[model samples]
Target: MHIAEGFLPVTHCVAWAAVATPFVAHGAVAVKKQLKAQPETKLLLAAAGAFSFVLSAIKIPSVTGSSSHPTGTALGAVLFKPPVMALLGTLVLFFQALLLAHGGITTLGANVFAMAIVGPWVAYGVWRASRGAGASMDLAVFLAALLGNLATYVVTATQLALAHHAQGLVQAWLTFMGLYAPTQVPIAVIEAIVTVLIVRALSKIAVPELQRLGFLPEPAQPVAQKVGI
Candidate 1:
């Protein structure tokens, strides 16, 4: 969900931009370190960014009148972790705003916070948590995408509620959430399935790249060849 241009108050926009700055900065640092460690990550990073831009740009109208779509942050978060994913995600947001007019500059901070930073960070946590809880990679990836998509909508609703704090914040928040949930819930489920598909394809051919990016464990085993009789 994007907060359209000038939709938020100036103060609200500036406040969110301010809040998102350091996280972006930290993400930049993480990107630098990752590139230094695994130069091959650049191509994968580009693919991840492109994935986010393509999927997230396909916004379907929702009850909020704002529209909803897949975040695509789960793939990046699972592959690169939040710090790196946050950096990549912001790039996607900026480009979409600049070239595609999908989002806007004033609301850039708020959008970035919701879709880029918080969503990926939460997804990364869910991915790790699910993996630690002995879930399969498929399940982990699904939960990451599903929960991450939900988290983004939640953050967007909160931002709208805060901006309209003239209305009771709690009521506004719940109202905004109610408006978005119908579209977002189904979008989240679709995103989870899509993420699993993407991960499965990558797992088959990009084990080294995935392992290098820390998505796969060290000493990753090669995919076993299936011999046809």
Candidate 2:
């Protein structure tokens, strides 16, 4: 669902770039801190970046000439922190735009805002909530992935509405949401199931890997109070 360059008006592009700059900067700093805190995480992040790039490229056609694909934010957030996921996503998008031409440079900021910022943060938020309640990790991961994918479309719809507004199009924001939600929701559900299955298998074989990668907290000797995210 990468919005091409020139799809949005120049004004919207400039506005989104301005708004997204600080978040992008903050995300980069967080990634740097993560690398320093755990040097091995750099390898994990690179692997996730490569994985995301490949995953996002495999798309299923949707209405409106858009396509559905795995957001990959859930996997990243489950392996690394959300901020780190954002960095990984940015790198993946950069390479995709450069090599594959999957997305455009001009719309990079908006794409990052939708997929990287909104998706990972949504997943992380759900993960945190579920973990605090001592919910099953598998279930939490599923819901987090589901919400992240759904939120990507929501954010994209908002961005599109904003672009239309700048261009004086008659379409309303709610209208855009209404049109996009029908297509996005079903795909999101499928993504959630896939993510849950993968995480479940990973948890069985490599629980410590999850912990080391910051997906799960260090296990307590007797299992301490539940923590989220």
Maximum-TM-score candidate: 1
Clashes of each: 0, 0
What local distance difference test score does each model get? 0.89, 0.77
lDDT of candidate model 2 versus the reference: 0.77
User: For residues 59-90, what per-residue lDDT tens digits would candidate 1 score against the true structure?
Assistant: 89976665888989989888988888778888
Give the Cα RMSD of candidate 2: 4.8
Q: What is the C-alpha RMSD of each candidate to the true structure, in Å?
A: 4.8, 4.8
lDDT of 2 at 214: 62
Q: Kindly state the number of residue pairs that clash in model 1.
A: 0
TM-score of 1: 0.92
Which 10-residue window of candidate 1 scores lowest in summed lDDT?
Answer: 220-229
For model 2, where is the 10-residue window of minimal lDDT?
220-229
